[model samples]
Target: MQPHFAVPNLAVPTFAPASDAGLPLHIVTERTLEAWLSQQDAATAGWARTMGFSGAWGQVVVLPGPDGTASGALVGAGSPKSRQRQRFLLAAAAAKLPEGTYALASDLPADLSPEVECFGWLMAQYAFDRYAKNTGAKARLIAPEGVDAARVEVMAAGETFTRTLINTPAEDMGPEQLQQAVESLAEVHGATVTTVVGEDLLAQDFPLIHTVGRASDRAPRLIDMRWGSEGPTLTLVGKGVCFDTGGLNLKPGASMALMKKDMGGSANVLGLAHMIMATGLRLQLRVLIPAVENAVSGPAFRPGDILTSRKGLTVEINNTDAEGRLVLADALALAQEDTPDLLISMATLTGAARVAVGADIAPFFTDREGDAVTLASNAQDAADPVWRLPFHAPYEAMIEPGIADLDNAPSGGLAGAITAALFLRRFAGEARYMHFDVFGWCPSSLPARPKGGVGQGTRALFQALPDMLALS
Candidate 1:
């Protein structure tokens, strides 16, 4: 069965008219005066004071009416100029406020853009209650004036899709299921999809992909989807390792617990594709996912075995757990064949990236300084943070194990994320390549982000594409 989750649809009525909106939700900061409280009546102000509400960030207090029923609510907006607070200020309000339709009672700070607030509000309402029952009702917020409601809705929809795909268990989100999701997306957008599965992958020269996935009962496949035929060509490749048992190497129980999210890279790529298509960005878009499950069996590829890649480079499998980069190698080789104007690869490829940048910030690698600068700026603008890590060409020797042109994973374990990027870069050729080593998970809950599958750097790329590709 397909995974089930309810994502807020931005196309519908996202806001209520001020005339009929039930509650007046005030966003207060440390500087906010009690004078605004006077508008609520003496009893409401007294209740707020008794609750010790000093407008600290994310604090919420409800005002009780004379009848002991709810009259309104007050939420902390934090500092007017702090980027961190403004990023998801409304999200806190959306999550904590009682179930009802609420509207903004006070003018938001100039720095707290309406788009950010609207997007955060929509995201905060997300709930992944597929296996469990959610008895509580969700709070609703009216879209503020002058905000692009439709754009925010599309963004929220894309992020919700990403989270849903990543959160589903491995049994339900294997290679076949991933194909189904792609087919569903194609049907919605009038895009075309082609697949090379099982022996077909070998016949088509994707030997590494076949080698890694052949052991699984679920057949592995390469999903190729194409959308739009004009403007600059943009190719996106995501590692679709449905589950990583680490193959012959094997992972400890704790390490494998969340392997279901291994395909998080593919989920995020599809999410970005959704946003691009929804906005009708002027670009010829192609998405490549080497969907596989790195399972163990007699047929599973083992460490120290050398295999020929689609790009004709020999790779020695040093560690089966590093299968993400292996599958991506073949896909990136394919993407570079046409020499697209931009080639981007994203993967949950290395724990070193997590150790360095942590889970919240996505670390990207690229040789283009200008593109790196643009991406950083766009990431900030989108409120989706990304940091650039150097390609570090000197470490290329680490990937060369003498027996083959490349090593699946190098020894010594230093600059791991960089070395993996270097390995993939060999196959990328002359294409303007960008690789994102994303954690693809939120270990804990934040304002708009939940403690599950998340879309890291996806929004940053979405925001940067128009300018990067010179699209009008």
Candidate 2:
């Protein structure tokens, strides 16, 4: 039987056609509620007050028509101070609205983007119900004027692909399954995929990747996806550690609970790839994913072992749990060989990244100052939210031990996220490189975000690509 993964419906049913007719939705906040109510007739204004609609965040109240049927509704957008701390605030109100298509009648908050709001409105209806059914009257929204309908749909599709891959269990998303995803995506996008699996990895000089995954029955491989024939070269390398059991080091049950999401980097890359190809972005795109499972067996790479990478740098493994970077090291070296204009690696590399920025923010490291500045700004605008962590040249000595050219896990465990980035940088060599240490799972459900695997930096990078490539 073929391995199956759920693909959620992200394009339709959540949005009505772009026709000009939709029920009016009046957006308001606590401070502006009185002024808006003053213009209303006695009955409508009195009914709102009687329903206790004081315009707190996400508060919604429906207005009765002259003949006692539904007319329109009022939604609270909250103050700017409160809006900064949340996402998809209006979508929360949309979820509560009755099953009808609604359109914005009033202007949005000054600081928000109608594009982003529409994207959230569509994403809020997603459900991963592969084995179960999602029951609800899906309240749809009309695509607001001045927003690109196709762009938002592409984002929703990419995001749905990412969330589904990350949420699937390890049994169905191993190296082979992951390759299937790449193949399926390539088939749809007219891209080509090539992979080196099992012992063939050692033949291809991917020793670090093979060592980390040799114990798994499913085998390890490097998935290479190529698309687009013209424009600047952009290579994306994602750490596809399907499951991290910490190898021989062995993670306890608590630490291993969410290991299914360890390949979030690969998921996000594919998501970004989907957006790029579908949106007709001008670029020759290359996606490299080193898919492996750090399993424990007699053949598993040991903590004290030293291995030579594809770049020929020696790595001393102090902890088997640090396998994500090991697999990424070899993949980055392979990507650097092409000398792409910009090389980016994304991985669920270290716990210290989460310690530094929490789960809501994606923390990144890059050697290029221009990329750092542009990415941070674009991420905020895209509502993806990325923070830059330095490459820290002074800490170069931290990752070096007397035994090997690099230490997989430095002693003392301080500045772990930085040291890991520094380690991957060594493999990437002179290629202009960027790295993302992202927490790809949303631990708690909030607004449009369901409690499951999520895409961290994909959208921001999508928005910044044209600028990064100097496209006209």
Best by lDDT: 2
- Residue lDDT tens for model 2, 1-472: 0112234332232467877467889998888999999989999899999999988888899888999867889988888888888788667877788877888899888888888888888778766665567633376788888988778878887888888889888988899989988998888788899999999999989999999999988899999999999999999999999999998889999999999999999999998998899887889999999999989988999888999999999999999999999999999999999999999999988999999999999999987888888998899898999999999999999999979999999989899999999999999989999999999999987766788889999999999989988865
Model 1, 367-400: lDDT tens digits are 9998999999989878899999999989999999
lDDT at 327 for candidate 1? Answer: 95
TM-score of 1: 0.94
For model 2 the local lDDT of residue 276 reads: 91
TM-score of each: 0.94, 0.96
Native-vs-model 2 lDDT? 0.88
Clashes of 2: 0
Task: Give the top-scoring candidate (TM-score).
Answer: 2
Segments in model 2 whose C-alpha atoms lie over 4 Å from true places: 1-14, 66-69, 135-137
Candidate 1 lDDT for residue 148: 67
* Per-residue lDDT of 107 in model 1: 80
Clashes (candidate 1)? 0
